[model samples]
Target: MAEQNVPIQRMTIIRTLLLFLAWFNQFLSMNGYSPLPFSDQELEVGVSMLVTFVVSIWTWWKNNDITKKARSRTEYLKGKGIM
Candidate 1:
């Protein structure tokens, strides 16, 4: 389907921002950003990286021209420039 050129909603902006923050938190917590030790740090880092990967894949699947889509505050690396 042809995509619309109209701007998206502001609520979408707010919601996307929240989602990005939540993902970043996971990325931090999983990396043992605080009290977690080095051994557990690996686990956290692995989980965060995996989550990041999944988000990027999902975003690409949702939008064929990923770069052409509107800027969203999502945490996926693929959506970086747009955001």
Candidate 2:
């Protein structure tokens, strides 16, 4: 299938911002600043689940692209502008 020219940098920035917000929220809670109504334990659990889910999905998506299309590690790195 032909891939769309998705902006990887834009996606990365957005994902980073989202993950930062999750961690920042947790940080605030840990320091006794509760932004949400949930208790600390509840908040911790919720954030843990959210971070795990996002990371899992991100890992799967990136790995799928690399494994399905890249001929080698070097090719994958080059494609990602990391080489």
Candidate 3:
């Protein structure tokens, strides 16, 4: 059970970092600055962040759906006096 939580924790950290990066990039752009003094680097980081955000949302949705189904099944079984 604890082992199953590791991935979720890691993903949470990754998502936080990615969001920070996205915000940092926007701040730099608004201030006429760049992290690496390169135009393309910021664009790459933005694209990567967009991809990560989409993937994270998809993963969360799937996980939530699965958990909901599992919980409902457990409740149904309990109602039937099976466990």
Candidate 4:
């Protein structure tokens, strides 16, 4: 069975959204606007999640190309009875 790879472009989009959300939240805070009445701790958690999401996305993007290449190599090897 072949392992599936995450699409880097989709992850990039998700990362962008996470970053935008974090920035928008901060912007609202600076303007003294509270949309949902979230606590400081909850805001902190939101930032943490954004950071984690971006980091994971970066990691996946970094590895996706390598994973595709490896899969192609594996297919070639199997075709040549080298696996």
Worst 10 contiguous positions by lDDT, candidate 1 = 65-74
Per model, how many backbone clashes are there? 1, 0, 0, 0
Q: Which ten residues in a row are the worst by lDDT in model 4?
A: 61-70
lDDT of 3 by residue, 10-58 (tens): 8889999999999998998799886665569777998899999999999
lDDT of 2 by residue, 22-62 (tens): 99999997997877888779989999999999999999877
Model 2 lDDT-worst window of ten: 62-71
Off by over 4 Å in 2: 1-33, 66-83
Per-candidate TM equals: 0.35, 0.42, 0.37, 0.39
Candidate 1 per-residue lDDT, tens place, 1-83, comes to: 99879998999999999999888878988996853355767978988999999999998877764454433335465556644
Better of 3 and 4 by TM-score: 4
On lDDT, the leading prediction is 4
Pick the winner on TM-score between candidates 2 and 3. 2
lDDT of candidates 1 onward, in order:
0.76, 0.84, 0.83, 0.87
The prediction achieving the highest TM-score against the true structure is: 2
Model 2: number of backbone collisions: 0
Task: Please give the distance, in angstroms, between residue 34's alpha carbon in candidate 2 and its true position after superposition.
Answer: 3.3
Return the candidate ranking by lDDT, descending.
Answer: 4, 2, 3, 1
Instruction: Quote the lDDT for 52 in model 2.
Output: 100
> What digit string (tens of lDDT, one per residue) describes model 4 on residues 15-81?
9999999899899879989866779899899989999999999999876645777889878989999
